[model samples]
Target: MNSVMITGCSSGFGLETARFFFEKGWHVIATMRKPDNSLFPTSDRLSILELDVTDQNSIDRAVREAGPIDVLINNAGIGYMSPFENTSDEIVHKLFDTNTFGTFNMVRAVVPQMRGRKAGTIINLSSSTTLKPLTFMSTYTASKAAVTAYTECLALELAPLGIRTVLIIPGLSPSTSFGKNAGDKISKSGEPADEYKALMEKVQSEFQREMLVQELTKPEDVVNAIWQAVTDSNCPVCLPAGPDAVALSQ
Candidate 1:
């Protein structure tokens, strides 16, 4: 069985993707900031560990414990919704820390082991927003855009070592509570006060509507793409999880 290490398996795509691989007979190492009570049920093939992607020490420890991962899936991320101008410096930094630098640190931890074997695959999870700009999602879009760009460059850099780098872009996956949680996080942040509250709420509601109606890509869609990228000998550098994402990319 292939050995795989997947991050952010507390919920959403990360959780689903980890389950998918485990069911396919792969040994899966699933990491989350809080894993003791994971949403995913206990399984023989699945091992859950605590991992905060923003922390390099956590990344290092998890990578060391997982050992010789055949596939590394960088799926942990956070979202912030507010006007670009209203987005606080801390918020912007947190977004990049988890979505961009987190990915960088994880890849850094695993790539050397992959290089030693000259046989491994790295799959970066990105967003369709990288293709189509969205309002109030400037920081989120920028983070995923950075992931896509980094994946592209890494693909070229790692190609010579027989290790491959790939990206899977998922359109609005409504099955996850990402939007709801993100909105709640911002509202609870106490940043958008008095004058800006109405506008912020409007943008968030509109985004929720779009997610419900036009962008309901499920976790299955992303997991399937991940499987293809990890198992297929000739997966492309970038793969779209749904038709909407494919069209947007074009």
Candidate 2:
């Protein structure tokens, strides 16, 4: 059976995707920062491993343990929201470490095997906020925008090697850790500056309102998009997931 290794399987898209593929009879290597078998249904086809995508040693070890695989899903990322001025260098670095470099490092770890075998699929999860910049989310948007741009370029580079690179743009969803993490980051970063105060408050209000009123990108939408990316030769390189994401793409 074909095997797939996915990062960030603790929750949201990664977790659901892992479950979906395993139910489809694919060997699933579901990885999180800390392994917890209880989060998954018991199955001989499932392999849960601890992985911290920001660390090369952790990635190398996970890749080694995962062995050869037909698919790699780069879904491990963190979200933060703050005015650009309020976003410290350290916070920006952390964002890039987990949201950007983490993805790049994971690709580096798994690409060698995929390149040699000349077959594999690389699916990355990027945010739909990148399509339309948010008032207080410039930093977060930039990080995810980098992923979208990188995947587009990587697709062309990998096609000749018989490997496909696909980008999945997902909009806001309650199931993901984004809201919690972003709120935590902003709390730690302290409140917005006086100049940005009014704008930030208005943005936050609208954001909460949107959550209540808008149809978000569901975990299932992302899982289905990933399935098509891996199984359909004619699927687009960039597939937007959810109602908001699809609408933004067009």
Q: Which candidate is the best by lDDT?
A: 2
After superposition on all CA atoms, how large is the RMSD of candidate 2? 1.7
TM-score of each: 0.90, 0.95
Q: Which candidate's TM-score is highest?
A: 2
lDDT of 2 by residue, 83-174 (tens): 88888888888788888999999998999999999999999989999987888788888989999999999999999998999999988887
lDDT of each: 0.84, 0.89
Mark the regions of model 2 whose C-alpha exceeds 4 Å error after superposition. Answer: 179-187
- Please, what are the lDDT tens digits per residue for candidate 1 over residues 1-250? 7899998887889888888887888899999887855465677677888888889989889888887788999998887666776777777888888889999999999999899999999999999888888777888899999999999999999999989999999988667766543442243344655777787778778877876678557788888889899878788899999767877878
230: Cα error in model 2, Å: 0.7
- Model 2 misses residue 14 by how many Å? 0.9
Model 2 Cα displacement at 174 (Å)?
Answer: 2.1
Instruction: Return the lDDT, model 1, position 73.
Output: 95
